[model samples]
Target: MRFKSLRKSNQVFIFAALLFAGLYYGAGLLVPLTFAVFFAALVLPVIYWLEKKTGIGKPFSSFLGTLLIFIGIGILLFFFVQQLGVFLQDIIESKDQIISYLRKVQLKAADVTGFSLQEQNKLLEESIMELLNMTQTYVSGILTGITGLVLNFLLVLILMFLVLLNRDKFEKFLMMYIKPERQEETKEVIQEARKVAYKYLWGRLQVMTILAALYLVLFTAYDLRHTGLLILFGALITIIPYIGPFISGTLPILFLIIFGGTVEEIISFTILIAIVQLIESYVLEPIIIGSEVEQSPLFIILAIILGGMLWGPAGFILFVPIFSMLKIVFDHTKGLEPVGYLLGNERPGSKENLMEKIKRKIGRKN
Candidate 1:
């Protein structure tokens, strides 16, 4: 029996590996669908509320919700373009300063490493030329693929609208496939998963908003060039988890250094970022996001890595909620509770065995 069980486990692992392979290779199609599903879930409450309040049908309400989301994205993109223009202008104006800073950095590096300045300059020029060639290739590829990218984006929007409109039908269809005895449990799992996803997405938006406001104030106070652009990009990039904030902070600091910021200014800004990160890690995340999904840190990190490997950036954004949904399903199912526990956050005193505690209570009664 033990051997048979082990064989079954191996089969399951093999199946999962195959599924992941498909996901990685089929990312072009799957990524947008994944995005649509998440988008549908995120805006579901708004759609329902609008339907209830306005007495409109689900189809109309879903369209309105999708439109609102599209408009919001459009506005953000508009501002991003404007800020990018300003950033480019600033870079152009500071070109000489940037070159001076680069030369100083090259010299400093040569001095520390005992390499001649000429050798250092030669290496730097080679690296820059390679980077420019890569950039040119990347730009051309993007130009060629722009049409398909737009079409895929539109398809995602359409899919999101359809999913929202037919959400009830989809739920019923899922229930129809399940055995009658398990239908209620399945429904409970579905509801729980939806609740977790909604809460997580909403909490993320709140966190991003607060962080952007803080960054804006801080950057403005420091008199940083292109403060608005930095804050927007930084806050959005922080959604990547872990290393994202460091990258975001480094970009602005590098820009400042290139454009003639003082050492004191650089040090002060770095210190300010550390302090803000402390507040975000300790206070804002706990209070605002809470423990809705309760995924273990190790598992979350693994998910981020796997997601990045499979779907690139979209995977990073989607994998946490995907894992959270899986956890909900595992928790609801009789045989998968162990898997759910493995994914869950560790809690103090939760290690006590429930059966042992029950036995102790019985002994006490005796």
Candidate 2:
């Protein structure tokens, strides 16, 4: 009986490994729809809860919640556009001075690094133009994309409503396949998976808000070029996790240096970026994600890169959460529990470091 159980377990594990492998590769093909569905899952819960609490009915509450969401999105987009326009106008007004500053910075770079600044500028300009041109190439396709976007939006909204409306039915559908003894465990897993998604969305916003304020203050105090833009950049880009901080921080530093920054000023900027990321990674992410979440820096980086490689920047944003959700599911299953352990935050040190610090402080006081 023991051997039979062991063999069954091993067989289940093998099947799960193959299943996930297919899903991982299939993600490349399904990212757009997957992301739309992912966002739906995030938004639907609140809409569902509100409807239940107030007896507002599914149709009206969903309509109201979706209207509010769209309105909020419009406001944010409007605000972003207005800010960007003003920032660009300021940059244009300072174009002559900006050019002069960049020239000086270029000459300085040549002196320090023995490179041709003109060549570097030409390369940067060409790269930017090339990317823009590539986007322009997709202009005709963009019309089709917009149409698809609208269709997808409607689909997601409908799906969300249906999912919420039939939440119990969906649970029953899944639970039907499982043994009676394991039905409760299966339900618990679904609940926990949703919580992971919710935690990521909420916690990410909180972390981004903190970083945005810090970047805004730092840039404004220092009189950095395009301060408003940099702040917006910091706020938006940080959502991408591992690569976001570097990209957000790097562009500003590069721009500053290209406009003739002192080495000390450059160092200050670098240090600030470093400190912010250290706090974000070592302090904030750990605190917010807690023991319930398990992800490594390396895996996060890989996920982002693979996501980007597959589906541009949007892919980078979605990849971690999608994989994390899968990890949660895999961990809960008896056969794939070991694989979950491998993927999850099992490090004793990073979490323990915080406790040890507290321990040392108490010992000192005694």
Task: List TM-scores for all candidates, in order.
Answer: 0.85, 0.73
Clashes of 1: 0
For residues 149-255, write the lDDT of model 2, one tens digit per residue: 55655665555555545656777888889999998888888888888777777677777778788888777766787676677767778888757877877888876
Best model number under TM-score: 1
Q: lDDT score, residue 102, model 2? A: 59
Model 1, range 196-248, lDDT digits (tens) per residue? 88888887888888989898888888888888888888888777767677777
lDDT of 2: 0.70
Model 2 — which ten-residue stretch has the worst lDDT?
135-144
Q: Which TM-score value belongs to model 1? A: 0.85
Clashes of each: 0, 1
lDDT values of the candidates?
A: 0.80, 0.70
